[model samples]
Each structure stands twice: as structure tokens, then as C-alpha cells.
Target: MDASEINAITDWLIDGARSAPMPSQMMAQACERMVAAGLPLWRVGVFIRTLHPEIFGRNFIWRQGAPEVEVGTVDFEIQETPEFKRSPLSLVFNRGLEVRGNPDNLADVERFPFLLDLRQEGATDYVAMPLRFLDDTVHAMTLTTKQPGGFSDAQVAALRALTKPLTRITEIITLRRTATTLLDTYVGNRAGERIMGGQIRRGHTDTMQAVIWLSDLRGFTALSDRLPAETVVEILNHYFDCQVASIRAHGGEVLKFMGDGLLAVFPIDEYIGDANHVCARVLEAARESRCSVDALAFPIGEAIERFRFGVALHVGNILYGNIGGGNRLDFTCIGPAVNLAARLEKIAGRMGRTVVASEGFVRACGADWNELGEFPIAGFSTAQRVYGLADEAPVVMA
Candidate 1:
């Protein structure tokens, strides 16, 4: 690109980044730019549903003003990668490489279905830009031209620069939306059979067996009141990041974050692995996460604040799935089990404990527990036996 063209493109990029629209809106703006620049079509997809990076990475094509590829559909496709061929965007998504040009000449595209679809749809020219942060490859951006040969070198370079900043904005938007989605689902009790993200078993009732996990930040509401909005957001986001990493690493699905708390579940059935193993792993992860939080308080040159968390786990049958009317639906868990989990969380707070599980859950865990005696939880009539997973360390709320 010449200096003038480079400057113009950079200006456009900064404007686009500054606008910071929703994903759908971002795609719309992207397509508008491509069309204005004389390209025929444009696409932006993130490969999240597919565990295997090689399949269709999160892919979307914006033609004209419509959102041809919606987020839900993209997530489904990612989760449903077949046993045979993986999606084409997998190359750029998993391998950290930018793919450009037509598949007939780009050997990698010769075997990809998404490319074939684009080709069928009259997208002859293509360019895929991989966004990499540090060593791990997060996602990719693909731009298309309907002309027979795909994008030109100049066009590809222009699109690449345009999308680099735009891609980070997209990632941030994705994470925020994902967090919001989980929160809505759990809070509304709409998450059903697919509670923990494994495939829905054919013929199985939409019902699911789950280990409901509720985690709350001690004094979060107060902290929010005392701290600046930006500071509050940063602290909660960092805390949530730690919790989410721990939950996913231990094979649990984080359902939501309600103000200062989190809801997660271990759908043993969906996990397909040993339920006990998964539970043990998640507990270990929780301890590690707590330790991580503690370590963060003293590491840097600046003084750091410490935070405490309360966690409660309950295993029972709960209704799960999408809930709501029209466009406001949520994917979340429902039923007495969810309520009981939350109640248990409250009990944990009263007892000044970090983690607690019911007697039934403790028995299922097959681990020795230090009993906290029968306690009358506010919402329940009978006193329930709660136990701390104190096989090693004592439980303290915070």
C-alpha cells in the first residue's frame, strides 16, 4: 500500500475500532467497507463450537446488509464437526497462518468445505487472516471477493490491516457476550438438557442430571459501591477470568455470573468422562484458582487487593435449555436444584466457609468431609447437613 492509501486505510481502521459495535453490527460495517472498496462479499467467523480447530473456524459471510451467518448457528456447526473432514478455517484458526486467494490455487483450500461453499456462492477470491496473541492462536478473519480469482495482494493487505484491530474488538465482544449469555441462562433457569455443553443425546428427555455450582464474591456489592465503575469491572472481569479458566480446565461449564457471584455446573452425563474424576478435578481447580487469586495480591510493583469466594455444589435433576419469548430467550438451568444450590451458597456465607456441598453430594464425591452440623437454610424447612471438603485445608468463607 502507498503512503496515502496506507494512511486512509489506517484512518478507516481507527474509526471502525472506535465505533465498537456488536458482532452483527461489526459484520455489517465490515461488509459495507468491503463493498465500498469494490469487493463483492465479506465474511467473519470464530471457530468456537468446533473443539477441533481444523474444521470450520467460526465462519460468517455478510452479503449486502443481512447477517447470513448468525452466532448460534456458527456455534452449533463448531460443536457438530463430523468424524471425516474438518472445517476449512481450521488451518488458519489452529495453525496460526493467514489464508488468501482461491482454493483451486491455494492447496489448503482444495479440501475445505467452507471454501467450497464460498466457491459455489460465487466467491472466487478469498483471504483468511489469523489473529494471534502471544503463542496461542485465538481466531481468524476471512474476507472474500466474488470475482473468479479471489482477493488481490493489495486488497488482502488492506483487509488484513483493517481487521487486525477489528479482530481484537471482536474477541472482547465475544467474551463479554459469552459471559452475559451464561449469566442470563442460569439466572432465568432456562438451561436444559444441554446444560454442560456435551451433545444432546437422541431421545433423551430435555431433563438433565447436574452438579450445580454457585460461587459468590464476598462483599462484591459493597466493593462495587466503593470502587469506580471501571475498576469494579476490571476486578470482576479478572476474577471471572480466573474462575472460568479453572472451570473449563476441570471440565465444567460456567453457566453465569450474577453481579458478584457465578453459577457453573458439571453435567456428568454430557461430560462422557468419569463424573467423580471431573468433580475432583474441578475442586482441585477451585483451590488452585483461590491460590492464584492470593498470589496476585502481592506480585506486582503496585499494591494489590485480595478477594474471597464462596462456593456451593449440589447434584440433582434440573430443567435446562433455552427459555424466553421471541428474541429474549436464555439457555440456563431451572428447578429446585438450582434454588437449593443458591441457598447452599447463602449458608456458606453464614458459616464463614469457602466451599460446602450437601451430604448427598459428599457421599457421591466419595471423599471424607468435615461436617458443619445440621443447619437451617432460610428457604428450606428442614435442617440440612452440610459438609466442607476439608480433607486437606480448612474451609473459610471469603
Candidate 2:
């Protein structure tokens, strides 16, 4: 490719490709543009590091004449694997080194076991370049060709020149993704979307009817007092995992993890379903959490001990939005409904029941429940009627 053609591709990266909706689409178009500019490109891959709880990074793969790019994620554990250690991507990611070789050559194939697979697929040239961001964080991009001889010296130089513009584009995409992932990880998904959509002002709350859920570990104080700090954290994580998985599976968003307690909600959306539907799902989540906690066992030296938790469910309107001091604000829900849920959770612990609910929740659920009688709540003036699952027998706590 000539100097003008390379410059055109660079311009496209800065202007056109930067606007692509996703990294996969950007990579596919970039590869197609490089091929159109007379570069012998059969396959292209771009690897970008990301900030996520589970995923370490993402890889976008583009093959010639393919309909769409193939995207995959790498976990943090991959860094410890022998395959990653021997791969060219590791060098590009860690040492910011450029790797160029003939995949068909025995020496190169021996050095990189993956090259042998490419050689079998008729790949001749392979080049991996480090895409150094402005912050000096190194990402990776690789180009492979099936052409007989491989990329020419001028073509390699052109590809290297394109990296500067490509790095900027990649950095933009990565930063956006990191921001989104971090928000979603810290706050719930719905809250994250609202914040991203510019609903960040304090006291900006929306009133919505939802099935409010509050749960707490029954003996967390005693357990934490006996166990090490790290052990307590591990146990808490395991306990929350059981509830979080079930809640999310049943269309609920966990908002906060306060010590040994958790707060979540199942919004009653007109488009999704009615109050009854949402209440039923919350009941399912509650039952699943109960069973999971019952089965959870922890070992303390010589013996294994089981743990339990209490959940309180109620259906009412809640204020969901940002609320806090000047600079640091918390995106969460608050109202009398949440307070009642908190009170009901304490009642569940006192009553030796695993799960308890308010009258509104039981009515919406339309399930067989045993009325646990009216009890005076701390904040409320009138006594509230609570109920428990009819089939769930009360456990004897030591």
C-alpha cells in the first residue's frame, strides 16, 4: 500500500472507525479497510484489557470474508497458564514487544505452539504489535496472512504506522467500557444505566412500586467475633453469592451489601408484568436463598458448622436514586417501605423463621402463608401483620 492509502486508513480510524458502536465492529471494519488498501491480511485480532470483576480482558477476532467479528473474554487465571506464557500476546501485553515471524517456519512454530495451528490453516506471516496507550498501558493487535511470502517490508511499516491512530481509538473504546463496567459492578444495572444517562444529581429520585427485599445473616456477629477477619469476609461472600444469584435470576437487583445484610428490589414494571408476577418471583428468590443458606457449611478446624439467614419481603413504593453528601453520593433506594423490610427482617430472626413477609407481599403473592400475628414496628405507629411460608417449619437456633 502507498503512503496516501495508509494515511487514509489512519484518517478513517480517527474519524469513521472511532464511531463504531462496539470494539468488535471497529476491529472488523479496520481489518476490511487494511485489506482494501492492498495489505495481505487474512486474519486480524485486537486484545484490550478491561476493568471488570470477572473478565481480565477481551479479544476481537476478524477473519477475511466473515460476516461478523468473533469476540471472546479472558479470565484473570489465564495469566498463570503455560499457553499464555508462551504466546506472543503475553509479550505484547507485558513487555510491550513487537513479534514478527513466519507461521510456516518450523523455528517460529516451535517457539509459539499456536503458530503451528495457523501454519496448518495456510498462514505464512504473523505479526503482533503492542498498542501503547497514552497512560503507557500496553494492549495487543495481531495480523496474519495466508499469502505465499508474507507481508512486505513496506506493508509491515505501514501496519506499524497505523498503530498510533489505532491506539487512540482503542483507548477511547476501552475507557468507555471500563466506566460502564465499573458502574455496573458497583451499583446495580438499572441504576448504572440511569447514572450513565445523566441521572446523577443528588435528591433526583423516582418513585416506583417494587417488592423490597432485605436479608441479614442470623449469627454473623458471633461468627465474625470467633473467626478471623479474612474468614469472616469469605463467609460473607459465600453467603451473599447464594442470595445474589437467585435474586438476579428472578429479575431483582441487589442494591447494597451492608456488613452482613443485603438490600434488593424487584421492580413491578408494566411492560414486564404486574405486582402479582413480581411478588411471585421474589418468593421464589426467597425460597432459593433459604435452601442455599441451609445447605451452606463452613469448617472451623475440627468440625463443620451450618449457617442461616433471615429475609423480609414487602411490596410498596420506594424512592430510587442518588442520595448522599456533597461529593460522595450513594445510588440506592430509601423510604418507609425499605424501613419496614428492615423491621420485618429483625422480626424473622426473633421468631426463628427463615423468611417473613408483610401483608401486602402475601396478598400479592397469593400463596399459602401462616399469619405470624400483628407486631408493633419501631418506626411505625400501628402494628403490622407479618406472615411466613406455610410449609416452612421454624428452626431451633442455639
Candidate number achieving the greatest lDDT relative to the actual structure: 2
Tell me how many clashing residue pairs each candidate has: 23, 0
- Tens-digit lDDT string for candidate 2 (1-398): 65777788899888848557777878887888888888989999999988898999999989998899999999999999999999999899999999987887888878899998888899989999999988899999999999889998988989999998999988988987888888888898999899989999998899999999999998888998888999899889889998999999999998999999999999998676599988998999999998898899988789997898999999999999999999799999999999999999999999999889999999989999999999999989999999999998888778
- What stretches of model 1 exceed 4 Å from their correct place? 1-205, 270-274, 298-302, 391-398
Task: Give stretches of model 2 more than 4 Å off.
Answer: 16-19, 270-273
> Model 1, residue 226: what's the lDDT?
73
Poorest stretch of ten by lDDT in candidate 1: 48-57
Tens digits of per-residue lDDT, candidate 1, 10-49, equal 5655565455356666666656655665655545454432
State the displacement of the C-alpha of residue 107, model 1, in Å, after optimal TM-score superposition.
29
Worst 10 residues of 2 by lDDT: 16-25
Clashing pairs in 2: none
Each prediction's TM-score versus the true structure: 0.50, 0.97
